[model samples]
Target: MNLIRLVLCVCAVFGTQLAQADATRYPLTIQSCNRDVTFNEAPKHAVSHDINMTHMMLALGLKPHMTGYSGISGWKAVTPQMKVILDGLPELASKYPSVETLLNANVDFFFAGWDYGMRVGGDLTPQTLTPLGINVYELTESCAFVMKRPPASMEDTYNDLRNLGKIFDVQDRANALIAHMQQEISEVQKTLPASKPRVFLYDSGEDRAMTSGRLGIPHALIEAAGGNDILSDIDASWTRINWETVVERNPEVIVIVDYSEVTAEQKQHFLETHPALQSVDAIRHKRFIVIPYVQATPGIDNVLAIQTLAKGFHPQ
Candidate 1:
């Protein structure tokens, strides 16, 4: 009987130790766009790429864990709250890092999308780095094959943040962040107009206009802000469309997507001077609302984009 009791006591101790190890090391597995990735312990040396992933890390207060990052255009694109966090970190590259650069950084983990680093058949692809003891995670919205859904929603933001929280063992912070975002979104929703405005999203183009379509996040943001996207019927995310369509639809408000190279003013000038667009009511009245190109996509900045658009639509 004493021997049996001893075995029970040993089992209890072992179980307790196992639980403690889990709490500390955090053995976790997450299914990404194409594969299942497992982490025996949180990454000590990690690198993030692009504004979307970098902003998420900052929001979670995980700066200490990140050793390096890349792909941010400028301080102008970054929110002030995030800029303070980014100012203290090491920048690996102004754009996407080369495979050699990433390897030399001794990085154990990478946070980037397919376009950012894991492009098909590229040297920095997840498939290439996985064998080298490096783990790569693609941004949720950037996953196109077998994982993406048409018309992105804010829920994608919540789920992505929650996943990151799980990986870093900071689920509480993620939950709080999500709750705050929801509250901000709710406040914007309250100020929405009774009638949804017809919004034309002009990205940039002279010969053929490039614009957001049904699969893009801008379509979802416009709907959330109580505006109807004239090109929401197009199935692709970003596509080139004829100016005749713009002239026919005649959007009430022109939403100019501001980027680093192409300023919002340039796009506005193009629309204002376009021979075909002169008859459009938005052009006639010069009703223009500008949003940073980064904010129009899937990211934490989307709520702010919604709020800005709401005010533009309902200008009280």
Candidate 2:
């Protein structure tokens, strides 16, 4: 009789724990782009896309919830910051996965951006997935025209981290992370040069010079780093300009965006060998600085990019 009573008591305790755990007390609803997203409970299985989006998940301590992820192979290499948090998460694809693959993964949530999962009528968009009861969140900067957006700034990065934290019930971690980033940015901004140098961001293109413009985070990064984006006059995030136009502007320093396909050395060589750039100040003086392609984008690394450019541009 004592053994039977002991078993019944144990079962009662176990049942109570299960019932409490099953209660979804916080039903979260937030406006994301064109859609109203509601999360009845935190997602147990998730899929993330692109470096920045994946980094956000890991930074928020959501790695255990991420059943699978995609787009890690595209980076030149996994950054040290990403390496520690990644912790052997399964990679679903080197790039974006197909709608069928996403469906098969049985992910309850998707953390991706416009180009990552929603490519102009491509499958696996929030429009298609939300109907199936999957929650989706877009990287704020990538939501540029999908919704009315403020100008790209470090605030966008903070908002993303904060939103993800709220969704996953980790608001404290998000606030702490944002505070650290803000402090770092403030320190770097204090050391800026009195005069901003004219900088040309070399992203990759032999035929035409493709560079960053006023619309994207790179433009803000240039401004923060004590340099002026010579192509800032352009309204779009990134655009193409001719070699003659480059000569006309005559940037004082060249900031080469490093990626896997085109080495910074190759771009430096192209600038040095081109006849049109013979008299260009940056090329002639060989004042070239290389930044990782990921750092040039909006993410946790943007602060580091700012500090790097400050040293390169002001090198006094």
lDDT of 2 by residue, 206-262 (tens): 899878667677888888888888877776655677889889999999988887667
Which candidate ranks first by TM-score, i.e. highest?
2
Cα error of candidate 1 at position 212, Å: 2.2
lDDT of 2 at 250: 93
Off by over 4 Å in 1: 1-25, 74-83, 116-118, 145-148
Going through the candidates in the order shown, the clash numbers are: 0, 0
- Residue 207 in model 2: shift from native, Å? 1.6
Q: Provide the overall lDDT of each model, using Cα atoms, as 2-decimal numbers.
A: 0.76, 0.76
What does candidate 1's lDDT look like per residue over 1-316, in tens digits? 1222323433444444332222334578987766788988888788988776777786676788888888775424555554666787888877768877878889888998765455777777788888998898777666653355666567767778877877887666666666666777898898676898789998888998988787667887888899988988776666789999999999999998887677888889989999999999899999999987667767777877898889898797
Q: Report per-prediction Cα RMSD to one decimal.
A: 10.6, 10.3
